[model samples]
Target: MGGEHSPHVPERVPSDDDPADDLPDGLLVADRDGRVVVFNSAARRMTGIAASAALGRDFRDVLPLHDAEGRDWWKCLSPYEGLTIRTRHPERSLFLADGHELLVTAGYRRDAEGRVERFSVCLRDAAHRARQERDRADLVSTVAHELRSPLTSVKGFTATLLAKWTRFNDDQKRVMLETVNADADRVTRLITELLDVSRIEAGRLEMHRQVVDLAGEARKVIAGRVAAGDPEDRFRFEARGELPEMWLDPDKVDQILGNLVENAVRHGAGTVTIVVEPDAHKEGAAVTVRDEGEGIPPEAAQRVFRQFWRGPGGNRRGGTGLGLYIVKGLVEAHGGAITVRRGPEGGAEFRFTVPAGAPDYAS
Candidate 1:
């Protein structure tokens, strides 16, 4: 099927004024006769075929693409024989003879009678799409791994309790039931995290505005840690200035503080400190959480808030790494910003500020 192209094929070197060369993706245009008449610089670069060699050549000969099943894509397309009303082929993954993959889309330019006058093919790198697939795979792996432990405990305990109901004393039975309850709560929390991640990513995170006491929220978080078996003496709360009531989402504030304080305990060490004060720049509030442990490395400060980030104690400490990312999203949704730095005690310090909602602010 390969043959010499038309000698009459027009050719011109692409220059700054050439709009086709400015395209981010490769573009190739061919006439009705099927010879490449417009091969932009991007096309030449993507295909590694010089303009001089491609301009006068058959479009299929210039770039031989095949489908995953090894079918010749150009023949499958049959651009010249498609339905008269068909003007485009949606983007799909294709491969060159050498096995390099590309994202391709085709368009047909037609005349009044619906006769093909010319056609164009667009080309894009497949890296971005491949990355998305990998990220999805990682999410599946994480969810499965996290669910396995709690679900296994729940199943084992329930089955054992049912099988040996009369063999165990009340105290032993109570312990098993309590363990099952904790595992169930773990599953529920994991599911909630998944939902929160989806909502945050889709920009659907909702907020309910109400008058709130910022310092009081911090105390509630510490009290929760104390109730959860953490030493009451291991945490401290400080208010530097007069606190003012502001309109904010109480649940979101609780969630934010809870995640930060938990992170300090899990990844850091020693006493945890919470500082709340009036926002000097805005009629809002600012809070800082610090711990007396090895802080986040300077090199990793920026990536700490990203999804799936892990610290030095990663595998040793249980976490999905979505905590800080969710914390960031929640804070930003509240018209606030968060940052991390080395604290005065040479430990990790996370500081976040939230703006007071507008007087007329409503959910």
Candidate 2:
């Protein structure tokens, strides 16, 4: 007789203290009569509706689910009442009364007699996830676009040289070959940055520590840049005091300096200044790289060290946008800290510190 009778619905709606309220995902339940029974905390947060306001109310009256074109979606739920279909619809855009959008996955719960007992909908803020997905896509597109330019140039130049070998004079051939070589170097740099990103993500970026002269390394970076045809007058190096040797990965230091200097040279105007001194407080050495270019905006400064962040105007000067991220990671890896601020010379100043003394070789 018990099995023959229909399932009984509770007289009172489920309270906020219901077991379903503990779920991380937003849970909304409506009984067979379409009255809201379970409006959990997550659901309240997602819809901006208090449990007190939603409980015991008709589901259709309490929740306004609208489509993109502002059409009511209440009719979509009617078919599930008698149907035995239990389904999950992911990323379903549901517009709330206050015009906020929620991405929800909804399901139906049925009784043994093949009747819908209740419906459960899980929800989250769609705008945030949508923005994240868009950013990821933009990063992928930017990297692909950056890589294609150099590859196109290299391929075209090499093909022309190989096909028309004897037709060109020595000087002409040399110029074309040099252009190809430069493009190849560009490709190599991009690939190296990509590899560095992968290594960083996998936590496999191992550092080979040794005693390195801080001031000496900074000089070498400036000299190398100038020797490679960077303007000699554009750079200035100053040692505030006698700098001490640091125990760190020398190559990583070179990379950190090289990236900062290159960013300055590309984005900066006038002269770029590099300063090295002993950090008495941290018992370490401090290095500052400042440029006389248009400094980073106050609002944009915080995002400078994030991966694939290229500021508001985009990468107009052919930057990968990973340099600063890599620099920050390398600084932290060396048990140091780095900061960016507006330089006195009206540009961005990056200062970092590395601990003095040799790293433990035993580890």
Candidate 3:
């Protein structure tokens, strides 16, 4: 008699036709018209609504839902077919009537002819993913924060000593100043390389290129260094024929020359030479810097330009390991290519070619 009077019997306890009936979370199904056609036991439990009461009502009217941005999820979902939705907005936390939180995903279904006929949305809580992101961000922030003060101190002390070099005895001044300067340079290189890598990854690298004299700039870099071990200064210039003027970025050319010369000075104990030749193998201007010191090991020759990479004995001296990377970036940005090889006499050589076309220096 109670059943006859009530008309409130639940759908026959999830027969094979309603596989979603036993799901742990809510399941919903609505027709294209947006009328509630199927509400599982889990959904009833989530929304605290009896199936009989929700059967024919509009899905939105029965249990309202909003997206992450506080927009009406039902309205957005109504027109689209087979789309999933996720929300992470602060104000619109995904909470059920029973005060439980859930991460929701909803998709639609269409008939064989490709007409959207029904849609279903299901949700599972996503408290874990949110926590992981927070932890990762915290770690990067902490590393950056801890590196600040020590780096600043190193740079500051080095500057102070350099500024007051005349006040100290020659022997004491040389030792202190060199050590301080080296450490400061090391720190500066690390910070700069880190920032550049970040910028490159973010696709924000901007190049300021202009017409430049490659031969003159190459000479300047060569003249600045004193030959450490070689009987004569390693810096040499060989013009195969007549050097051609090419349109390129002056700053980038300087950077390229400086990086190559510095690399030669660091690895080669002897002489480093800069040679300019008209491209015989290809059509372009070719510049080569060869060092007479111990050549790069066969295994390491190819990887010389990789980011944060170090060659044999590269560790004895301090470096950010970014010089070659920057060189490569700047060269490529100028529409040129750079290469490394072993010279005939026995040492490492780097050659790069700039194409004949005028580079848009403002990029």
Candidate 4:
């Protein structure tokens, strides 16, 4: 016979010995005395606690409640009645525990007499989803930064070259004309990257196969950038081994190198050195561009390649911010990887790999 009580009892009463009392979903039951009567398998899985040990203990002992400020949270529970509790902190993303993040909903349950009986919580891991959101935001910002400066120069200089070309002497005319043409080429590259990155995101960037002499191409890019006014003494280029012509897309390789060079010039101080090292694992070559300027802050390293990721302390000198991000994307498109680290003499260094091959120079 049961003790005299109201007809409104718990939907399911869990005994200390009944296996069926334990549910796969988070379930907890407390008695009128405010002691735990049942803490089921489901509850244990969500909170990472053992059900057997929670039985006969206070509910607070099972899941020690902590307020958003890390203060005691159980005092907020109502002794007269149970109520659902939703998180109030909008910035509280997800619960972090044991190197993992869990999405959770917490609530309370009561008996027919309006007495608190249980506190239930459900949770699911959310790391993958959060990472995807972060990556997407970074891509957008990167593209925006990369386009701003070159577009400004291409537009401003082309107009200046046009407005002043007729007033110049023959030598001046030749120089100004060459500069105009170079700026045009830079614009073309910006547009191409905008489209290429979009396609890469949509899984659309295609590689045209051909023999590519990376050394010659690198030298040509260096020559053009140097001619365009990057100081000659401040820049050095080298090749370590006899690089054989292999198959790859030349335009993409050019874009990658150009972006890295631009990054070195924009972020680093003093001289920038380009070092090419051959790699057997890649059957390709590793290219490193290092500068003597101040290195990126430790906190900003991982975020450097993210899209639209502006450097700390706002507009980094003359950088529009898209160089590193576009460099990473272009290298990955060529089946390569790109990374940055502090250089030997307290500046930023960018490194990427390219298949040792010949590329079709733009006609």
Best by lDDT: 1
lDDT of 3 by residue, 183-281 (tens): 667566667766766676566667665556677787766665543343344567776776555777676688789888888877775667888877776
Give one digit per residue, the lDDT tens place, for model 2 in 1-363: 001212365545556468887887787787766667788888887878887787766677767788888887666655354357555555678798778988877777677877777777777778778887997798789779888998899889889989998999999999998998988898888889988877876778898888888888999999999899987998999988876667888899999999999888888778999999999787889999999888889888889998876743467877788999899988988888899989998888999988875656512
Q: Which ten residues in a row have the lowest lDDT in candidate 4?
A: 84-93
Q: Model 4 over residues 198-293: C-alpha lDDT tens digits? A: 786676767776777777777877888889987789789888986556576778778777878777777678888888778657688888889898
Candidate number that wins on lDDT, 2 or 3: 2
Best by TM-score: 1
C-alpha lDDT of candidate 4 relative to the true structure = 0.65
Q: Candidate 3's error at 324, in angstroms? A: 1.2
When superposed on Cα atoms, how far off is each prediction in RMSD?
Answer: 6.9, 7.7, 15.0, 11.9
**Candidate 3, which ten residues in sequence have the lowest lDDT sum?**
1-10
- Give each model a TM-score: 0.71, 0.63, 0.53, 0.51
Displacement of the residue 48 alpha carbon in candidate 2, Å: 14
After TM-score superposition, the amount by which residue 334's alpha carbon in candidate 4 deviates from its true location, in angstroms, is 2.0
By TM-score, the better pick of 3 and 4 is 3
Give the C-alpha lDDT of model 2. Answer: 0.81
lDDT of 1 by residue, 1-363 (tens): 655656665654556688898887899998877888788887877778888887767888888999999999988888887789998999999998889889999999999999888889999879767897898999999889889998999999999999999999999999999999988998888788889989998999888989888888999999888998999999989999885667889999999999999999998888899999988888888999999999999999999998788876896798778899999999998999999999999889999999888658857
Ranking of candidates on TM-score, top first? 1, 2, 3, 4
Off by over 4 Å in 2: 1-132, 242-245, 311-316, 361-363
